[model samples]
Target chain A: MTDTTVKEPVQFFVTEDPHHHDGDHGEHHHETGTMLGFWIYLMSDCLIFGILFAVYAVLGGNYAAGPAPVDLFELDMILVSTFMLLFSSITYGFAVLRMDRNDLKGTLLWLVITGGFGVAFLYLEVLEFSHLIHLGATPQASAFLSSFFFLVGTHGMHVLGGSIWLVVLLIQLSQRGLTHENKRRVMCLSLFWHFLDLIWIGVFSLVYLTGVLL
Target chain B: MSDHAKGGHGSLKSYLIGFVLSVILTVIPFWVVMGEPLDNKGVAVAIIFILGGAQMLVHIHYFLHVTIKAEQGWQAMSMGLTILLLVIVLSGSIWVMFNLEENMMPAHEQIERVRNLP
Candidate 1:
């Protein structure tokens, strides 16, 4: 009975806005569905690449008395280009990690690094192709050359497109900050970047290494 | 958003691990091709392809974060279907195109048979 003439004040914590719970829940579902849709689109893109690989596999040996892979390919130069792409992939990973941390500048810095490596890779590839053409081994010289240029050129084009996408994403990040939608976009771009890396591994191993070896 | 969207899906450690594995995988194949360490061309080719597949898995797991622990059922189902379709389409296209090429050769029996048919 000494009691408690004094009363304790109640404390409340604000977490969710109860008024918007239902609408937010539906919107979350829609967002996840869109991500799945993006995955489907990527899978379809894989089909395009798979078909190209099939074409190369069928026509890879048709040199038509032109310069073959072993004659034209410089392993050292290609290796440098391969490392450039590989390093870009890791840099892109860093950008995604920064996105996770909500660090905008870090994300942009890493993205720029990724784009730099991509540009270097493309430059070396263009140099290699020009040298081949200068050596009178253009794509029109042989089926093998045609397939090689087509498969590898298509991949390089994808990288160029990805670089442009990165620039747009940087602009988006600057304008919008780290909104949920931007995060989804970063995840999608991460998938595309790594998917390209995976495809490059295939190209290097099957197209380059095997071609040179055989 | 999933827990992954909030970050911390993997870590820098995971990315480093993947990068190291990828480099090792790449270098070994290049060494096999460049150094001629193996006399048997078939074996060298097999090794390169196997290593390629392994490196792809490493990228998928570490960089892309595609695993059983990620997301849920629909993702796995879709991935499985996509892989299945890829295998079918690639193998089918290669097989068919090669067969067509072989049939078109002058010495091929199928070519002779077709000429006689007309």
Candidate 2:
């Protein structure tokens, strides 16, 4: 070999396991990363709800010449709404199960049912709020009403958002089929749906049920 | 395969269990409040709160799949931190507010008596 080109040792990056795909298994789909990010988001969401709850607790008993919880809260109405949401959460679980099984049609069917229940829940809440407002118990009526409206209204908004997400997801599921990315989206939405249900539990217990009791 | 190995993600059995428990917990409190099963308001409040707490655990465990095992304990860690913050925020707010109300707001009867005196 001609020694005319005496070159310095070439510097380049090297690795013993450069081609190892062990860590890059199914995780390349960004499933774990998205899940962790979503979880952090949910925790922050929890803080928001927590503060709202604290506000409700603080201002709950402040009638200020306005309607009290017992006067405004209808046990029957809230009970029905509670079941609507609880059922929706379970239906969402069914949808996720269908996703796990790669049954796109079944998933959509269950998601529709879940959305139906969500709509029913929001309807009941809207009706309750409207009835209260008609009876001169608007949020502007008193501190108690203000906190009640804000806390429950925030939760209702979340459900509305989830319902809209459900419609969009149904569209996505139809167009894209049950791809890995779609499945991850389903799981994330499922987490969100159930998280809302958890917060509702606190609301009904602390705000409504306990409110009437107190 | 990983999904299959990890328990509580989408199990039908767990969902059913959670649903049933949630319904019972909800119904019992409603009954206690509506029917006034116990004459004591405090007892009814205590029962409702306890059952409510249990039902929340059920939802967290089964529906949300928040177990000690999920995500290599990340779920539990985050959940624990959230619970701690919630307790602090909720209890602190309630305590401060209750004290504020006591110190600031007069009872209706006291107000009425003051009105008559003036």
Q: Estimate each model's TM-score.
A: 0.86, 0.87
lDDT tens digits by residue: candidate 2, A139-178: 8899899999999999999999999999999998898676
* Ten contiguous residues minimizing lDDT sum, candidate 2 chain A: A1-10
RMSD of each: 8.0, 9.3
lDDT tens per residue, model 1, A12-102: 3232222322563544455557667777787788788887888898889999988889999999888999899899989988888887777
User: How far out, in Å, is residue B50 in model 1?
Assistant: 0.5
Q: After superposition, which runs of candidate 1 have C-alpha atoms over 4 Å from their true positions?
A: A1-25, B1-4, B100-118
CAPRI-style grade of the A/B interface in model 1: medium
Give the C-alpha miss distance for residue B53 in model 2, angstroms: 0.7
Query: True-contact fraction for model 1?
Result: 0.66
